[model samples]
Target: MKISTTSSVLALAAASTGSAQTTTYTNQSAPFTLQIANSANASLNGLYLFSCHAGAAIEGICVGGSTPISGASSTFYYNTTDTDVSGSDDGQGLLVWNLPVSGLPGTDHVSQSAALQPYRPGTNVVVPLFGFDAGTPVHFDDDKLTIKDYYNDANYVAGQFPDSTPAETVYNNWYSCWTGVGGGYTYEALSWVTAGVPHNPTCEKIDVIRTFL
Candidate 1:
């Protein structure tokens, strides 16, 4: 599945399904591999993975800290956490968003469309995670995943800061370019929304196959 927005386009591809899928259970550790194609023509710096299950949206568990995404394609791994124990009990669906590389302050550079698939732990495969064909292009300057929403909706918290605080407001003001603190304010502003904004999740791809790394 893919979606196109006014300013940008997003993409996703199909994967395997049903009994061919294996569940990753609690207390088990495994590495899940993913690959992304940068059709947006922008360099990405991070990846935000989310899990949708039980009528609630939760942050998915990814082991390694994010790295830069560039070139025709990029590969990364979900190296952290016990997948089965962490995902929602009702269902295990995964969605992905790309964070573009930017130096602008108050610019929440997140993808607008999401790449989705069912969770199958212990599978190592190269999945064409996201791009312009599946979803809308991300607009960091406009579509924002607010810090308050992050705290209110998901289990992940922004740093050690309280879910909602005056500091967060200030940080968002500066991050969203509502203030004139300038580009140097990146670090301090980031302190406010530590988990960062997510994509709109307007698209999905099913039956994705797990590739062996």
Candidate 2:
């Protein structure tokens, strides 16, 4: 959904006074793609983020080429409406997907809303869970375009955590991990892992970059 004009005016006013307000104005530099930076694999570098099903668990987020999933769109734009009732910017904004999800498959269940939530209860890994109509206002660092939760302030990572089968490994960090289910094989999940947690493979910190067209 688009940001309200009134909200834009407020943002401008707050910005003028150097007060924190939801800044919707990308200064005409929006309509950008999010890229995962500092990835261990060179191929994953500069690739855009997209939505995908995390093996029937939930409609989750993934990162890779333009079309990481069968009918998912990687392009996204900022929705700077003040979602926080506190009326503070604090780097709050919605990462709205460019495409509509009405016609996507039932299994896909993609929503424009880009939300970072737990894949399930009692798990360290935080998965990007979408489907909110108003869209959750994620803590979007305008300078970095990096998504962070307000609670821990941890940077989202693309994990290569091990799978249950031992021999098989999943690119995403979901607990019930398996491989070769999604359309793209190497499309990794966007997650947040607790610091100092041990894993066979470490999660790579991802940076979201803005791109034109």
Candidate 3:
């Protein structure tokens, strides 16, 4: 059952920089749904490291939620970096990505301040996201790649050993928003998170890498 794919991304309007790019979420699944609880969420592939064999020339990772444009999709870049991700965990300082979904039109919580204070914890909201390799294959500048899932799965109880804590008590499901670079989980590249509110039937399907170019 071989099928053809197209670039699901777009060369979003730019000022004609030294390069170009497109991004998308692939729809190879049975139209799934992910519920990123208040402090817990995740993606399908569980990919921590994102890479782009888009030549040596660096490019920027463009991540625009329901807004027109926010980050650079042509100059910023990161590829093959490592990310230790889980299915749960949402912490402060976590950069989440936002894409439009079909059943879930209209996105929310779009701000244009570099202060990084979109809103109070749990103030913002979004629908489920469909992962993809939109448009063409190229390098992105990734100034803010923290836009991945709800936060890394911090299911592990934080405490001292020996006089230890109970690990068999709670069936934990999530973690925090630790960077994939150092400290917590180590990812190989860049990534983003697509989450929706709690108990809400929010589902969406944006441009997936319909067919790989």
Q: By lDDT, who's the top model here?
A: 2
Ranking by TM-score: 2, 1, 3
Clashes of each: 26, 0, 65
- Itemize residue pairs with steric clashes in candidate 2: none
User: Superposing all C-alpha atoms, what RMSD in Å does each candidate have to the true structure?
Assistant: 20.1, 14.0, 17.5
- lDDT tens digits, residues 1-213, model 2? 222223343333334422322243221124556666555566667666665654322245566574333333555666554444443336456665533323223322222455555344454555455433234445444435544432431333468443333331112222211222223343356665543452315356555555545
Question: Which ranking of candidates, highest lDDT first?
Answer: 2, 1, 3
- Once fitted onto the true fold, the runs of candidate 3 whose alpha carbons sit more than 4 angstroms away are 1-120, 123-151, 161-201, 204-207
For model 3, what is the C-alpha lDDT against the true structure?
0.21
- State every prediction's TM-score relative to the real structure: 0.20, 0.50, 0.19
The digit string of per-residue lDDT tens for model 1 on 1-213 reads 111232222111111111112122122223233322221322222332221111111112221224322321222222112454554223222223333423324443333123322223432111222332232111111222111212243444656654454322211211110111121111111111122341212112111112223
On lDDT, the stronger of 1 and 3 is: 1
The lDDT per prediction is 0.23, 0.44, 0.21
